[model samples]
Target: MNKRIFLSAPHMGGNELNYIQEAFDANYIAPVGRNIDEFEKQIKEYTGAKYALAVSSGTAAIHLALRVLGIKDGDEVMASTFTFIGSVAPILYERCTPFFIDSDTASWNLDPNLLEEELSQRAATGKKQPKALIVTHLYGQCADIVRIQNICEHYGVHLIEDAAESLGATLNAQHTGTFGKLGIYSFNGNKIITTSGGGMLVSDDEALLSYARHLSTQARDDAPHYEHNEYGYNYRMSNITAGIGRGQMEVLSERIKRRREIFNLYQKELNIIEGLSFMPELPSSVGNRWLTTILLPVHLSPEKIRVTLEKENIESRPLWKPMHAQPLFRDAKGCINGTSDTFFKKGICLPSSSSMNNDDIQRILSLLKPLLNC
Candidate 1:
């Protein structure tokens, strides 16, 4: 059998070892260390956000963001149903209900139309405005932020951009994660860039960052001795992982470039396929192209193509299972128009790691072209 081709996987930069060595040499093995500080600084600088906090995972960042938004039991938060479960699970952590909205086919993110409809319906019931609105930049393509932000503002809901897969993506020159009140980034192993495992919470408001830092560090109060004024969580990223992030950050731009190149290769090679289409990045959206996704036509289901690719020793996966479709969220309220559901049935994520050489890409194209022909 040929070497097993994978979906997106960690592509490391050589400089990561230096940061790890520095952390070991300085004995900064804990979460509170120089590496963490540097990583936060890098995020703030890159995103132009006033402040940032390094956290254990993207879900933790969203939980922290939801807490900062003051969501409580029974309060409602609006989110995209067509996102990774991690994006909406944090709302459940706060004991808040997630009012899911369907995705817009153009960007494969949240549909503003569905969002407006839900907001209007919720308001007509005379309830308090939603505690927050969580919009995701799914697959690194920036959502329609301008309209989403306008809607959130009109409705007085805090906007949390779950940009886990879109660290470098932009919308009309503005960064994806920076459009909302708070934004989160993930550095999971399969993400465009990886810190081995880490995430960030960023915002223009310094106080939010301060509070997030406090909450992440066990909410210990100011005292020389062990003390706490409120409950806390051990969600801060470790110095070692931050070291990996620092190294990964150094080559983030290069990784994005490579991922985009991979997308172009697929697009060029697979352009002739009648029933297949690559998800497009709109004019105003600058997708990091995190994972190259293709949507099979009605007759050619994504799963069918996935199995075909797998049999050829190449791996592919369906798009994220919309959160509302999951059993855990079966009871959650959602405004659906079959957009996300259709995407799920048709979309497949192809191999998009930056480490793929030209030969690897050719092999993927080779396997896919014949399958499309069949």
Candidate 2:
């Protein structure tokens, strides 16, 4: 049997150990240290965000975003129905009502037209507008962000970008996360870059970022003695973890390059199949290609493909199930366009770890092509 091929394994750069060692030597084992500062700095500079706050996980960042934005219980928060659970879990944490929005065939992301319609209809009917919209950049591809941002502004809704899968993605040469009021990036084990498990919250608003920083660290009031005026979460990212992030940030461009290369390779190999389509990128946008996802024909079940890959000691998986279809969200209000539902059934996320080589890709195509009847 061959070595196990993973579905987006972490690929570490060589400088990680050096940064970790430096942190250790300074005895900065806690969450506060140079590493965290540097990590946040790099993220802010790279994404063109004015400020950034490192937290325990991407979910924590989203929660903090909600807290800082003053979105509380019973507030309606709109979200992409086609995203991973982490993107919407924060809405639940805040005891807010979630309104799911379906994806579009063009970008496989939150539909801007639907969003505009919902907002306009609500306005005409004198219904309360949702406080915010949490739109996920699915599989690292940029959503129609500029148009979405315009819609959100016109509707007086806050935009919280769930860029967890799209750290390096950009639209019209502008980073995806910077377009929204708040944006988050994940450093989970399987992300394009990893610090084992961490997340960063970014925003152009300094006050919001500062308040988020305060809330992230248990909302402690500034004083020499231990003090707290309001409730908060212990969401700080450890210095040790930040060291890994600093190193990873250094290699992010390279990682995105490799991931895109891998995607192109898959496209070249798999486009020969009669009934397959790769995830599309919107014009004027460059996605990180965090994972190479494809839609399979009705005859080629994603489950069957995943199982066959697993049998070969290779890893693969299906795309996210629409949040509206989930049992928890069964009663939630949504623009039910059936696009995301269709994608959920037919999509497969192929192994796209930057560590994977051309040979690994060919091996995958060899197994997949037969099942696809190419």
Candidate 3:
């Protein structure tokens, strides 16, 4: 069998083990350690946020963000429909109602026009607007965040960016996760940079992050005795994983660059093929290009291509199914215009790991090109 081609495998920097060894030498195996502190520091420095909290996973970060924003108990929270479940799962955890917004052809992220219209309609009717909007930078690409942020501000809605797939992505000159009230980034095994598993919540508000830090550590009161004024999750990131993150941070820019190169290679190779087009980055933005996605022709299905690649031990996947289309969200409210649903049906994510080489891409194209042509 041919070697396996993963969608987005972890590509480690050379210094990961050195940091891990330092953590071990310090005997800081617990959550509260130098590694965790340094990891959070690195995130803040990189993302230009005033504060950051390293947590167990991206979902935990989102949950803490919602809690800090005081959005709960049936409060309406708006979100981008064309994203992974982790991006919006915390809304349910907080018992907040989610009103999903569809993507647009311009950025393949949330549609700002739809958002403006919805918020305007709500205001006109004297209807209660959503308390927050969780917008994802889909596939490491920038959402139209600046416009979205402006709209959210106009409507008195908090914007929480889901930059899990876009650690190094930028819109104009600003990083993605920093555009909103609170943003979260994932360092899962398959991300551009991996800490095995971890996440970071960033914000300009120091008090909010400090409160989230308390909540992440179980919301224990700072007393001599183990006392709790309120409940919170044990969502702290470990020193070991943070050690990995510290090293990952060292090479994040390089990883993003290589990923973009791979994306360019895919575009150069596949553009000539009829009815297939690569995902676009806005003229004013630069994406990490985490996974080079393509929208196939109407005659070709993403699933069929995914299955065919699986036969050759090459990994591929369909685009995210719109949240409103999920059975779990059948009763949820949404301002849908079929954009996300269409992308979901026709899009496929190709293997675009930073570790890939020209030969590896050729292997994929060798199989993929034939399928598309046929």
**Clash-forming residue pairs, model 1:** none
Question: What would the per-residue lDDT of candidate 1 be over residues 1-374, giving only the tens digit for each residue?
Answer: 98888898888899888998999999988988888999888888888888899999999999999887778798988898989988988888888888888988788888888888777877999866777889999899989899999999999989999999999999888888899999999998889888878899999988888899899989989999969878979999999999999999899999999999999988888877787888878787789999999888676767777888799788889998898888998898778888888888888999888899989999888777766773
lDDT of 3 at 28: 88
Give the worst 10-residue stretch by lDDT in candidate 3: 365-374
Clash list (residue pairs), candidate 2: none
lDDT tens per residue, model 3, 1-374? 98899999999889989888988999988898999999989988888999999999998999999999999999999999999999999999999899999999999999999999999999999999999999999999999999999999998999999999999899887999999999999999999999999999999998999999999999999888969989999999999999999999999999999999999988888899888888888889999998899999889989889999899999999999999999989999999999989999999999999999999999998988888783
lDDT score for candidate 3 against the true structure: 0.93
Return the TM-score for each candidate structure: 0.97, 0.99, 0.99
**Candidates sorted by lDDT, best first:** 2, 3, 1
| Candidate 2 wrongly placed segments (more than 4 Å) | none
Q: Which stretches of candidate 1 lie over 4 Å from their true place?
A: 121-127
As for lDDT, the candidate ahead, 1 or 3, is: 3
Clashing pairs in 3: none
Candidate with the larger lDDT of 1 and 2: 2
Task: Indicate the worst ten consecutive residues by lDDT in candidate 2.
Answer: 267-276
lDDT by residue (tens digit), candidate 2, 120-169: 99999999999999999999999999999999999999999999999989
